[model samples]
Target chain A: MSTSTSTSLTAPTASRVAGTAVLLGLTLAPFLLGPYAVATLSRILVFALLALSVNLLTGLTGLPTLGQSAYFGVGAYTAAVVAKNLTDIGPLQLLIAAGVSALVAVPTGWLAVRARGVVFLMLTLAIGEIVYSAAVNWKPVTGGTDGISGVPPVVPLPGTPALELDGLVYFYVLAVFLLLLGAVTRLGSTPFVLALRGIRDNEPRMKAIGYPTRRYALTVYCGAAALAGAAGSLWVSVQRFVSPGDAGFEIAALALLAVVIGGTGSMWGACAAAALIWLTRDYLGNLEAVAGRGPLLLGLLFVIAVYTLPRGLAGVRLPHQPSRKRTA
Target chain B: MAGWLDGNLVSVVDGIAFGLLLFTIAVGLSLVFGMMDVLNLAHGTLYLAGAYTAYALSDGTVPGLLLALAAGALVGALGGAALTLLTQPLARRGHLDQAVLTLGITFIVADLLAAAFGGEVLPTDPPASLRGTVDLLGHTYPVYRLVFIAVAAALALLVHLVFERSSLGALVRATVADRDMVRAQGVDIRKVLYGVFAFGAALAAVGGVLGAPILGPGPGVDESVLVLSLVVVVVGGLGSVRGALAGALLIGQVQTLGVALLPQYAPFLLFGTMLLVLVVRPHGLVPSAVRT
Candidate 1:
């Protein structure tokens, strides 16, 4: 609360510097680290993508949604279904997953865009649960909770070698992550995204000024869903399996929490927070001594973040941002 | 003719009973959100605490349940007061801060609970006095459910009378309508906020304790309760008691009837009903006039 004001006004340069440094460092991490570390980094990247997708809605558009799992599931299923039957072209799978997710978001976002604020949050949570149940129940296609396992490793390019279960797939995943992260960053900087920020700040004024607020909102929502779908596909590629739990409420909730903790409008902050959450949940959570207390630790981190670093990991503080303003 | 009439009667009674249970849990959410404009995501945690209390206190005896009720209410009130006090500093910061802050609290409490309770569903049984079943139209129904209905209905009546009839209720409503005006009238709005929050939390815990036999306590009961309460609050329209009752009954029947009739699609049916309701009445079935 204390630091929110000045950071918002001065965050552009600071965030850019931090973003580039983190991206470069992450891209170089796998090469320097061992196989186990590479695998962990791959998971972190997937989570980063998921958290960034959440930021697209919550931080950029002020939607505060808890439904990224819907898109994430779509991506995972797309990759799994394609890997099971069609080609294991990772790029193609990503595209199909994104497309399918965006398609589903059309009507879902239409219904969701009707409400704003807490109601919007509730609707998204319901939608996520419904989609998750469908995946759990729709047996033939979704594999009915068993999930589509035995997904083949993505076939490498014609000249290159295939990425078998070895550490080779890590590089491929890294490339895909970099490309998607770049695109998301570009998307966030676009005028269309600027319009979304405007909607987040003041919808009525935007509409009064003749901006087609609903259309813009729906578009952004679908786009973010597509990003989440891409992340899911990437998840499948790395894990080679998809489960109902992959699209469960915890993922959606964590992604939202990451965005909130990472400074809402800061993409780099989201990715950083995602990594933090992933490390906490996956690495620290699995420690033998701590046992099953990962959630407790993460919860403590959240409380600390709220109290100490209101701007989240990227630290994009707002300058005299008015409190008690109308929010959804 | 007798069989047809009997079946319909059974469904109606069952629906009302389920609705009453929902009302007991959801009214707390409605009052807290409506009156204080505080979106307490941890509302479900209080219910979870209450359910756990019931689990801890019950020895399959009536006196045990009475003790659980007292403990649940006390813990809930304390929890609510703590939440209000902790959040007062950021109350002026807006809903985003409040949301994040409460979410943090929810996560912390959920983890602590999971640790304490071993991450497994804990079954809780009603007292011996409320156990067993009674015959209804050639079908047997749990007697505890019937008791739940009676007790919940009475609680509802008490709540309605307190809010709609009592002068204290008038003051609370006055604060909700215009905080500055109530303060101008020499009423301490802060005290009212704390009291309402604590009281609402106590009510949620009480519902959790009473309904534990049916809903049960588990690792993720907090999330489920939170989601259900959200649905109830939304469908009932943010802060109105009548709205909360109507929404809870509608959802309660939807849950039981949908699961009974269409087991495969029960979850979807619940969501579908919610989607339909939202589409038809975006503000909810009963919107609060003062709050939004």
Candidate 2:
């Protein structure tokens, strides 16, 4: 519809400028914001990564997934268990987490990618619920929903001091997030992504053109799961606690909502929407005027966003393609 | 093994009751999913609303239970109509949009119910007359569940007859074939869509009302039921009443008996079962349409 068209109309220069400014804000956040605000920002960055993962499949590849949180949970628990027994190095934990998540994604994503549209959604959702149930019932490994905690603080590097301050931890999360974000952005111009968009627009046509659409879908599915798993690792570093709720339906739904509100396929849009949602949940919901009404406000936000921002906030940005098309 | 079967017969029978309850909820979801392609995530909210209705109305009497069922049906119908109205326009965009919109509705309604009923999971008791146990093959089982199995069996038969053999099935097929032609006949299409909603939502709500004693009304029941029913719908295949029945009964056994037998690996068992069924028959056990 209008969404796909408006998505193509975003001014690249304007997007770069906004992206730079946002990066600056994130880089300087520790010095500017309070400890609590910094912690929230850190969480937002992790959630934004999750939103990016959803953007990869749901937004980019046209496979509606409600199963990314399962990988997220897996990454977190893997990291927790790694920190407990394997290694306390943050990067190592992240690698192991992402690896584990991608491994889990193999069979689950295999089953999921067989169907498209709502059936795909159903399969992924059941996958998420299954993972969530496993997290709760697998007492020996997952800690039986209480999750793993009281681990040694993650050392960002091999020889560095273990991070204890929230500000310092925020920097570590920011670094990995930036790395992944850069990689995904670099992936945008590749022909593989072009194939993904093709699949999204019309799978039958893509298949008729001799493109292996299913493989494309499955590849993106694993990549997205890895990205979500990395986010989960960051989440562990930020909160130092993990729980079954991390892999629950709500997280998957919110991540998918972030992708939708961000304008499907718009990376920065998904990240921005994720931040906005988290702020609404953490700040606006807890504000004295609307305390304990977070879910209500979130619900209202969802309804309004779907109706008012059909093309999403990204689509609204620099909408006038005629004047903004000037090259640098 | 004989001793084990003898000991666990209650759990097996319990699975049937639980499965029937799942059928009531999943049948509506499956039909709407197959026909409309609308991702009604708030379908569980309707069930929650019905369970809450049961909790509010049940005075430990049969009349109260009946009243709760009727009221639950009304509440569910209204919710369904509202959801249909909210989501209808978004369907053209994509299922993702519908998913977001319906999820929003779910969040708003679930929070409202939570605020009204408190955050705790409230236990809803069966009517006084149905409270006692009944003897079955030298084993005692809840009278309400035994009655529920009978009622649900009858209900399932009725749904089968109504959708499969009745003229309504022809009308549905006709409408799906040509919308404008049906509209030309002076049937308000919105009302028909609303009727679809009412049928599906009413069934789910009634399931909630009757199932309140078994599943209870709680903060997270909506989500669990939603997931469970989604499992049933997928396992049974969409738009087929028989599919929903088969899937629900199978899942009911997996859930109850699996828990009773291997408490630790119950979730894996559910996954394994789903994976096995899907691997064998990707369209589910009884897909209504052999779609490409």
Candidate 3:
């Protein structure tokens, strides 16, 4: 739990410049990228959102989780059901999905917050596996692994036309991704997040200082679950389908890996690592040589990443960390 | 209620067999964690490897099963030793790194196993002698399951004796309690670490070899086994053999009997059970005395 060192809020101007530059590139990507690339980027954006949610807990809040995908799956299924029966409005689906996911997180998060370290990870994993089971066995609602399909195209607004084109959907995803990114960035600086970092750093000390660490852990857990749910909604909007696999262990694992590989406590790092991982899993995995060896290659990436990128891919500290020959 | 109880007596018996199987796998996981503070996520891969050994070596004979068990144990020990070597570097990196690193190993091994054995769950049958049915309290039961229960119970007793009553177990527990203290006594603490890890891994693999017929070995089976063992260890209190048995049996009942009674809520039953345990006994029903 105290594995990663803390990342301070430095390089504010450089980071802002990089953020704007990345946003500009993303805004112009639909024109430069092919439909498939655009669609993949959309998926990456959504996954990045999920990874950010994971980072909220692991990187910022100090609780490592392998269960965020449970919330993601809940959101995806909720959005699918809402789109199929209620409305095709993208924002509404996102809202309802996030809300339902947080609601589902209440009891689950409460139980999860009762423990820390490996115990917490184990609890969350059980929560995820149980939800995955529900998706597979609850045939009436979850459609029993075949999953809910035939989702209507996501409408961005009340009167706006549905987003059918990959580029259009990509834009919508990017917009939401950027919005959440800003929110999380703002959240990182808040006193509440400082308290969370304190809890992560030393929970006993925080408790000694009169902080309700358990309540904070639970609150952040629900918030992260809600964020994961929103990402799932974006996923539904992008794919126009929902499946049990969306909420499976792989999704949760990948999100956790993204946070870890991106440099814990760094939102930008999480997004970059999420993008890289998705690209690896989706793009490289489907190659002819390793056509169905997606898991194998991803596994290799995990091993290699763990060894070679110990500080993570986005672990750039221009002013603080100098290059080193050995671990100090 | 009487009708349900009478009808599900078979389920209760079956739960015993299943729980015993889990204990065989989970006890190793529990002790390794209890002693080493290392959470090897690839622990389930040992079970899968053993199952595949059963699938590969089964010749409808007792010798074949014994051979498979021996081979599986060797494979598991080698796997554990190798894991110890790989994970040793990350010892100071904290458990998150250890967990993620071992998880990487799990993914790699699971993928490799899936590649070699194909994607489908491989069904392994018991030896000719253990095959077929037997009458148990007016209910027809598989002979192999009854045999499994007996063997697994003996295995559990052996484990309990070795870990709780034996001098080696005392050393392992002492190491867990205070590594510096154990090393100060001139004991090669790393040897104990490797020994415990390899022994636990071997036990898990042996369970796989034995439980192949019950749980089967497949692509995702490794993950499922890992999760189940994790739950068992958590419920039984981490690193405690007694706790693993208690938790495994309870879960086995919930899995088998609960499913038989309410298929719709079987999965939730597992979660709800865990939730209740966490709420009522956060350290588990039987927590390890020298906590990590």
Candidate 4:
């Protein structure tokens, strides 16, 4: 999955410095941008997390899925339920949401992971649809198509004051986003991830090496579901409303599209692509002339991205990563 | 049990008709996927297009219905050809890329269709001669549905014979088994690929035309039909005619009866049935002998 084509002999120190600069810029972006842009950035961060979740299974484990949004919706609904009925503590809500989503993923993911390729894809798609249908039909529990609203403002911690302003909420989202981003980065370098990469590249070979590939896939599936659930919790926090649409196929498709456009295994690229896609949908679609044409534009973007960015945005060579030989 | 059967008799008949429609659509999908290893997510779009064609052309007459069917098949074939051209380049890239490309096509076509037909469900009427209800065992049933069932069953038999019993079927199966070997034997594999894709897509479109009176054409119809056909393909087994038939009929019953019996959980029944089937037989109810 980590098809790093660059074999450059550049100074590592320079790349480290550039990474620090980029992080610094992101940390200061909310303050520098307008309130509208800051809100959009927060949305981008939530979707970026979802895209990262998709990347874990799709990019890392080679299990293409269309069902992450089910977990996302589950997480969002759980958070909304907690906020309305139990507590407004953001951290607690996020934790419970992620935990529940992971739990739900177990049975579904087990069924899904048993198959490979298109069969797996079909199972996940069915799973997503079922979840969506449940959300719509289970009116007493899920509030039907209307969904749950009137979610209170999120408190970052147990004792901290609630985040009332958009700017403050953006900071709260960023904090959790960075913490999870760090966890995922650490995960990328783990032996488990290495095994997943092995499975992705050649499952039969990995099996011959005595690797329990299905177990790895299931574990990653649950982990990715947890990540998506956390993102869903944040989405509820940001929107203060959870609807069936939150868990619909469009959300799943867009998140996966973000992963594909960003480059499957590249985490940073996913975030960037998520931001670009969000902007295109949120900002460009609202333009006077193009109003209500968001889907059409998104469809065009998908076609163009697949044809032009076959290797994805992250696959582009950076200053330090000079290309040697390209893998066919 | 007799009382229950009497109560649910119409639903059972409806289920068979619905299943036959699904078979018409899904059989093509099973064949194309088995042979080409291409997962055309846009298969439902062809169905939508055919439904729209019926909506536009049918004037409640037998001749008009025939015209709609012909037009629907033609449109489906053209669409299949177009998709083949779009997907051929990605043959080496694997199913994920193919899924993405076809999904994109689906989105674009669905949008265009929405624009042309509006976003409402457009229901077509059966021909005047077929609009009346007829006596079934003890109750009356729609003549159109009964006719549709007969037509669809004939179609199923024709497809089964063509794919399972004919020399062309042998050639197609041979191509699927080993394209290189078939090419070495002086058969044009590309033509076969294109033909299979076109025929499969055309069949789906024809089903759509016939099914429009029952399911109707709406904004999200393509998505729903696509999911159902995917379910049919999975439960019936991937690439075989018998599998599609078995899967479609089973699902059709589940769908119609599940709704009648437990309206609240009908949606779950579709996926639940799929889950059970996969758990029991992962390859499907009737898996194709040749594995991809």
The root-mean-square deviation over C-alpha atoms between each candidate and the true structure, in angstroms, is 3.7, 4.6, 4.3, 3.5
lDDT of candidate 3 at residue B11, scale 0 to 100: 96
Q: Write the per-residue lDDT of candidate 1 for residues A146-199, one digit (tens) a residue.
A: 988999888756445558853678778888888988888777567898898889
**Can you write out model 2's per-residue Cα lDDT over A117-208, one digit (the tens) per residue?**
76677778778878898899889999996888887888999889999999999999999989999999999879999999888877889999
Ten contiguous residues minimizing lDDT sum, candidate 4 chain A: A319-328
Cα lDDT of candidate 4 equals 0.88
Model 3 bad stretches (over 4 Å): A1-21, A137-141, A316-328, B1-6, B287-292
lDDT (CA) per prediction: 0.84, 0.85, 0.88, 0.88
Give the C-alpha miss distance for residue A144 in model 2, angstroms. Answer: 2.9
Residue A267 Cα positional deviation in candidate 2, in Å, after optimal superposition: 0.6
Residues A80-160 of candidate 4 have per-residue lDDT tens digits of 999999999999999999999999999999989998876677688778888998899988878999999899999999899
The per-residue C-alpha lDDT of model 1 at residue A261 equals 83
The residue pairs found clashing in candidate 2 are none
Name the runs in model 1 displaced over 4 angstroms: A1-20, A156-159, A316-327, B1-5, B8-12, B287-292
Flag clash pairs in model 3.
none
Candidate 2 local lDDT, B9-90, one digit each (tens): 9999999999999999888888777666676778888889999999999999999999999999999888888888888887
Best by DockQ: 1
Predicted complexes: DockQ each:
0.59, 0.43, 0.41, 0.41
